[model samples]
Target chain A: MQIYATIAELVSAAETADLSLSELMIQQEVANSGNSRDEVWAGMERNLEAMAAAVKRGSTGEGAFSKTGLTGGEAIKLKNYRATHQSLSGDTMLAAVQNAIATNEVNAAMGIVCATPTAGASGTLPGVLFMLQERLNLTHEQMIRFLFTSGALGMIIANNAMIAGATGGCQAEVGSASGMAAAAAVEIAGGTPEQSAEALAMALSNLLGLVCDPIAGLVELPCVKRNAIGATNALISADMALAGLTNKIPADEVVGAMKKIGEDMPQTLRETGRGGLAATPTGIKMKMRIFGQDRDFE
Target chain B: MVLNYKSVFDIIGPVMIGPSSSHTAGAVAIGHAARKIFHAPATTLTVRYYESFAETHRGHGTDYALVAGVLGLPPADPQVPNALTLAQQQGLAVKFIEMAGPSPIGHPNTAIVTLSNEQRTIEVAGCSIGGGTIEIRRITVDGFELKPSGPLPILLVWGAKDNDQRIQTKLAKMTKIMRQQSYNTAAKHLVEFDLERSLQQHEVDSLQQGAAELVYL
Candidate 1:
């Protein structure tokens, strides 16, 4: 059986146990109602401004912004997907995404169904929702609520720990995202926060040491299309959570495990190109070639 | 019971990937954000996915997503992976590489989406977080995390007086508008507006332009 007496108890435990969740809730705003949302927004804005200031101080450099020109080239492809979905009006957002990706796009496509987030990860939520929606079509509001729920979970991960490749490794970023998304999916489908947290704990517990090492360092290499994979995992986690298979360990504990794993990771595997696959000769050659440091340059 | 509406689950998942939603979906979101931000054709580009993306990138279809993104593919595009091969076949010289070390601490799925021509490189790092929310983290051309999620249709105005304050104010106004217009409703507008503003700001150009790009699988 679970340890908590109620959902509030579980959330409180999570909040106290983790920084991300606590921050996401923005503890200062105890007042309920619409103002809470505003407070969240304000908190986010303040963080953004502060981050900007840090970036200016040269504290935070370009993490992944180096590949700007690629987006322009990708426009035509995305447009086609959008066109197909738009034509299929009145369809559920999940279906629209699935259909769009299935028809026009290429290497891989995944849908985010019940607890969807970024469009890149769009398929994950839709994919889950599609399967569930066919059984029971929920409204758009429900979908949004699912996302909000997921967002709440995501904020926890984002705050208390790491959602970046450099800090927590890839597991902390995508793994955390998938966990939150899974929690959201289950919640939207009528699961409880215990279920949501369980899903998150399950997801994170499984993906403890994922690293963030993009091929070529471009979002495209494994970045943009990884949504399909993220989506799939989100569904898997959601289903497990819904099924009542909870992680005996709390979600916060799992996050702690993740952070410790990341900290213990070698620099090469820590998105630093010093370890893991990045240390391969091929990787070295590739790095040289990409940076114009290859033999040809000599 | 007050209906604890949190989307918590008891048993969920065989989650797809991790260490980054930004590196994954956030990246695609960035691609889509770019399409909406530029609303123009992108002829030349230099993409970089960090270490995680570079390693197992083929499995994740980041290549396809970037190509599809450049071509204006939606976030939901299935051919995101195939788009890269398609683009390569088209002679776009869509190069790929692995980057080293962490550049900054914002969103992990950070990419400098530069809408450019031979004359100018209007670069921007589209920071896509979970749920398709994006922020123009910074512009390489001019250093500033001017919120790009606004509907004001303003330029980055590099070095413009009160640019930061202006952007912040605009974003505040936009979020206010979105909240007022759809208070009870979940605000999709906020996400879109935020991305739009980030895309137009061209923040990514300032830092990682012409550098090695990485992708994680």
Candidate 2:
């Protein structure tokens, strides 16, 4: 895992090792943990199972409220809406959106979720993976491979730049997860590693400079809904890469750009919940209603 | 690029109950660590959320998560959200204070807590370093600081700086000992060091025989 710090290194290593990104990541995990291949794979399989259960609870349950009373049943509503109406985004995209919403909703409700980097951005990877699972009729092996591939990309971002909003803004959280999902989706869709790398760049470029400002400082509000967009972003980027489109900027440079942008952002735009949507009139009202105090924000 | 060797699972999984991993799971880790190091009964707990944690504590369940951790609840426990009610049930009075504006230093996500019982009080300063990882920056048992209280086994002693040699000798006999810090006052010195492995209960009693207090974790 420490061997490769950037996507360029990852791709080259894949080529040299004559292995796919997922295979290389699995090897690294095996070497690092001194665990048998079966044990590592089974451990990730458990995480996937937990992810699926969260989606089930969020999309099917009568919709529980978060501690803040913000974020809960939107996932179920979207699921119901997709069932009855012709979604403008089409079934697969809509399904991904709902699934993304479901996992984040589960997080908001204090249900268990596997943080794909961080819990605030947990939904994007699972959203993209499960949708591909259903759409491509992927086996458990393929799904686990998707996760490994996603983890590989996330590792690069986490190593070279950041993945937590507190350090890198929403661009680091949902943005990193989206990029990871896009690259993984491309690989599982049988696109070349180069194409997957291109998708990674494209997905990150689409959401660069995004801020992390959850109203009332909760992971509800924008966080859950943003993951839906992240899932869709990954989908389009994967499609673009599969069609041979590429980013002008290299994937690693794009990640570097995101880091710079996040550094330049004011504290309010970070996870302080001080500025952006968190500072909106309605946001302040909600905060007062929930916590009975306005943010001491200037 | 500065490459931090965070595991792929660090990117993928803690499988924690959360709205925000840093605020909830990281906070839980801090409280849990503080309690593990305190290793004593706490009648009252006072927590101060700093900077980013202060602003977003309530929304992220940082409050419940911290209290839950002190109550020995893991981040995955479904009861984390119900921590406040549970605290009341157990008669642990918890106080929370949120401070706005920027943190002067350290990580933006930070929490400082004091857990006090009848005879003693333990103070801990912790930072949630994102991705559900935490840094137990300062763990103080009655002003005795534990330096480098990381994942390593720690043996902290509060006594005379003169006893530092004796304690080192006793510690060396038990395991490999590397002394880290010894902060001394007029009458007492808080000697701190990391141990190769945990010390036995009888060994701890022996170390505390002439010392004011000794905590082993």
Candidate 3:
């Protein structure tokens, strides 16, 4: 019951056990937590159901405005636009983007969300999972397996590197989420475990040093739109890995690099709303507008 | 560290009501833990919000969530936003003091909660480490440090004037004790026990009537 600390070890364990990454993860969960496989699957299925419900409620444009009135209805707008007009990104990608936005919008509006790694980046995995389910004609069980695969990757990152924006940054929140989703997408597409790791590396490297700067210190504003971008990043990385693209650095090394960068980052960049876009003039105006004054935040 | 992720739920979901996981859910968890430590509803409470939590907790609903937690509401409870009003109606005198600068413990999102009644006081400090998970960094009853985490049942016994053997004899009957630690100062003796199975409510009340405090983690 030793914890797997790196992608290489997890892949090796999967190979030795003669199981896929999702199967290995399920086994590990049963061993570590004393839960039956059926019980674990039931729990994951519940989360999947909740995520689907959030997506449905959010996409319908039902009370999406957050408390600060910053971000709302953008997901519905995207869904509507995709319905009437042809998007250059195609229906599958557009659906991923829309679902991602929808989930995060629900989160901002204080609706329940399944935090894929964290609530601030909750949208990416569910977005890609539901979209690919339709496009690939995947079953419910397959979508559950995809969540298991993503969970395995997320566990490794959280154990070895970081996953909290306060501890690392948005690079740790959305970036880790993007990596998890990309790896899951690779698994759903029938790629090897190593290929999935490559997808994660590619996805994370693209988002290194990303800050957690929510406007007015709310999880609305850029957070909801960023989930859209994170989902798109996940899909693109998954496609590249499926097409035989590889990262120059190993996935473990890239995760280490992310941890190092997070450590070196100033406090202002790590969820304090003191730097990045949160410090912009528009950001200040929004804060003033929401709170009715320039409150002494710092 | 053991990297405490035992299931996929810890990674992909807590299925919580939230704007920020660390701020809202984690804050609720801290308050929940504090409530458990007190063994009864806190008649009076003082909560200290530190650093980033002090700055933006209102926006994230951390303030409401923490109050809801102490009122025995779960993180996903819909009434969390109205917890303060509920606390007022319940006659729980709660006060919040926003502390400037980061905690000495270094986590940006931290809270120290003190719960008290006419006879006793307990203080607990906790950090929400994202994704609705939390760590109980410190706990002090009187002046002795006690550590408890998760949902296990805990028993704390402070002997009268160093009468440690009297309490140890009483604890011998509890089934499936997971951990036991003891602390001693000049005037008092403290023994902490963590159990696999929770003590019955009657058993908890019996212990409370004595010199012991039974806490459910």
TM-score of each: 0.45, 0.85, 0.90
Docking class of 1: incorrect
Highest lDDT: give the candidate number.
2
Off by over 4 Å in 2: A1-3, A67-69, A295-298, B1-5, B141-217
Q: What C-alpha lDDT, on a 0 to 100 scale, does residue A127 get in candidate 1?
A: 41
lDDT of 3 by residue, A1-298 (tens): 4467789899888778767899989888776655679988999999999899888878984536687778888888888888899999898898998899889988999988898889999998888998998999999989999999999999888877777777788999999999999998998999988889999999999999888887777888788988888899999999999999999899999999999998888877777666788889999888888878644533
Could you tell me which 10 consecutive residues in candidate 3 chain B have the lowest summed lDDT?
B161-170
The number of clashing residue pairs in each candidate reads 148, 0, 1
The best candidate by DockQ is 3
Q: Best-fitting candidate, measured by TM-score?
A: 3
Candidate 1 residue-wise lDDT, B29-98, digit = tens: 5565455444445556666544344443443445555567677555444455467776666555556555
Per residue, candidate 2 scores C-alpha lDDT tens digits across A3-31 of 56779989988888778999989988776
Question: What is the C-alpha local distance difference test score of each model?
Answer: 0.45, 0.83, 0.81
Candidate 2 chain A weakest lDDT stretch, 10 residues: A289-298
Query: Which is the winner by DockQ between candidate 1 and candidate 3?
Result: 3
Q: After superposition, how far is residue B194 of candidate 3 from its true place, in Å?
A: 8.6
